[model samples]
Target: MSLRTGETIKFRSVGERTEYAAKILSADEDTIVIETKPGARPELSAGQYVILIAAETNYNAQIMSADASQVRLRWLRTDKQEYFRVDDFFPVVARKVEKNLLDTKASMTVTFSKEAIDRSPPDETIHPKLWDLLVSLDEKLNLILDRLNLEPEPVEAEPQQVNISASGIRFMIKDKVEQGDMLEVKMLLPTTPMVSIVAYGQVVSSECLGSAGYVVAVQFVNMDSEVRDRLIQYTLNRQREIIRKQRQLE
Candidate 1:
């Protein structure tokens, strides 16, 4: 099948379930070139075979050439199953779910509402005088809070290199978590207006790295459509940025 330049695609080694995100740099009917993050690049050599998933269809491809940044593959045949996934990094915080916390969903909604309001465009129909007055009042309130030292300092999670997709995320943590454990995950995406997401995940895998910590993989559960769309958009934008930078270097 034909592929477009700069289109995001997913691929993994034959017989492997873990997929990696890549961007199609160039393509033709028989051969295609793709680029991936240096860290996420698939371990491949010339003549190796892999599966490429694009546009919801899977294809078997033989690696024609491979390097740290790019790979060339010759299409072999198509598979029957449909698959899709993309990965990227963002700042994230995760914790084991507490059975006593009944208000977690409410807290998540409040956080999302605040971020939505902050990023939304001003109402064009509002009266100019009323808008100015509202802005003035907000400023005054901030000034008063500052004078009283009452403004709450924002609590931010330490940034980590996470492999995030719409379905789940994988990252390293100091603590170990057992498989099948439930976790509350919060991720901050550095989009144009920024997005903060809170979702519940079930731990699927956890591997100890000894002194380095543990690599934990979690699958998202009950994530809303809006949040999933936001994640997909962020990954697409990130892929474009990566492709642009790679082209410049070429």
Candidate 2:
């Protein structure tokens, strides 16, 4: 579902299902950058392209790297025990495409997926603030989605409640939750999770929820494979959805 590096997914809602690849440039908190072009990298606005407008049928892309002049933040990876060079992952800002939006450089509603690979070359350098945002966005979204999608089903021939907890945060769910239920997934950090991560989900069928662990036995529908996949794109695209977005981000 997540258009990862060398991976592909279809976009059905808008038009014919078009497949796209991912090119992760930088991955973090608020923002993520991807090298849209394949093969070798290019200069400013090189192969990178973006939709000059979202109304036309034809598509175009350009550099979307964030400017180096903006603010910079120190990115510390607690688990990795390393700090991402502040200016190593700067995002190049380009525009995004939609049916009808004034993002001729507007901040589009971008999302990421949890399933992505690492394409961030150690030599891939960028500005400071942008890099920090990418890292933060990636980690935050992954943690949020994992917990947000956590729900419990009532075991047959049993009487009990489905309680979910992980990392540190905890919550209780009603017995036998239907698909598409809105689960509150709070981050376990020493703080609160993003209010936006508490998203609305649709009930999906059991067969669609992949066979991962005992989760498949659950009702599985709050988000079907398609929706879940898209969310996964939004959820995991941070580091892996680069090539796909590059083709579409324009």
Candidate 3:
């Protein structure tokens, strides 16, 4: 995606090895200018590379200049050999997507009850006692579903690798999927206070990865901002933990 003025962009500081977000101040065909805070000396120097994460794609950019007011970056094309090495410096595009639970029992129960109620006789075929029992059962199921912390059911027996972030998810699937196919993705984030996000996505890419398995990438469509923020926060926390473990080992 083209960088627009006032759009927030993420890049890593080559020196500090820390990621920072900046707002684009202006952009042209050759270079894009981003605002920098005063008193914060630039951590990136001219000719150094920083990975600019644009949506699902990452771009390797060379720093042209760094000043108190702004920093200029020249984007490199994907055809460049150095562009492929961008992930070596910063793996911003590689996100962890663990297979997770997707609870649909409540919804299923509701649907089943509705069907049962509709099929029941209007006045005489079903006994009053049986009708009362059905009503009681429906009430009980609803009570169970109304809980804040509902027991989750695993969608798969074992976890599969799914590259995921707040923005989207990419996972292997055997089922045929077409580009732009709409899907309702339900996932449970295995974090403290366990967040459940039910998001809709459109299949962006699906390629056969061999053995009848297809790797499908889906982009979230009109997702709630709050859930997206929570996913982002969860990813950040996981990254921190990974960094801490690496430091300990070193």
Candidate 4:
């Protein structure tokens, strides 16, 4: 298997379950070199066996050399897994789903579609003439609103640091939520087009952090293929940006 420089890979010790992300610095037919966070250095050492995952394909490797910033591994062979996981941070807002809401699934679907449409910019290429007319109408509406001293309230939530994967998310919030409670989560991915995603998640864990608030872990449900693809792309893009910034600091 060939690995590209600066590409992100996830790995963990064969005996351990936790996975961590690393950037490939170089690769060859038999060996690959990667840079990981300093905290990971302790878990990896010469002769330690690990499982490395790249683009959903798994490989067996034995560590040749390990240090605070880099690890060299001798690739043993290739393996397979059903899926791969990647995680990163983004701005997120989550609220508990009230049980009394009727037709919850339909309501959530409509809300998700509307949020996506409202946040996305108008595509001028779809219908140029109609786009022009809509732009003119919007301008007139804004003018009328300005004359009436009426303005729409900002609905965007304040950006919060949220660790998110395609399957789940972890964030800190002030409200207490019990395990198994469902929540409506909305997040904005700071990508080229700034994608907005709305999904529902079930609370898996919630731990109080005293004055700081509570740390909540939620697993997403009812996610469609398109949203999952967007999440995977977002993670890959975020990994690239992180690696680029790390190189600049070197």
Q: Identify the candidate with maximal TM-score.
A: 1
Q: Put down candidate 2 lDDT per residue, 1-250, tens digits, no spaces.
A: 1212322211111112333333444434433344333422222332222221112222222233423321111111112221111101111111112312212211112334445634354455765566766766666545443433233532221111222111111122333333323222211221122222222211121233233211211111122234334333433433344457577978
Please say which candidate is ahead in lDDT: 1 or 2: 1
Residue 17 lDDT in candidate 1: 79
TM-score of 4: 0.46
Candidate 2 has a TM-score of 0.19
Q: Against the unseen true structure, what C-alpha lDDT does each candidate score?
A: 0.66, 0.27, 0.54, 0.65
Stretches > 4 Å off in candidate 4: 1-89, 98-156
- lDDT (Cα, tens digit) per residue for candidate 3, span 201-237: 5565679867867777766645465766666776777
Cα-based lDDT at residue 10, candidate 2: 16
The candidate that achieves the highest lDDT relative to the unseen native structure = 1
The Cα error of candidate 2 at residue 57, in Å, is 31
In model 1, the Cα lDDT at residue 52 comes to 82
Instruction: Indicate the worst ten consecutive residues by lDDT in candidate 4.
Output: 106-115
Clashing pairs in 3: none
lDDT of 1 by residue, 129-216 (tens): 7776675444433332222211144434555678776767898877778765667776666543345677776676799999988899
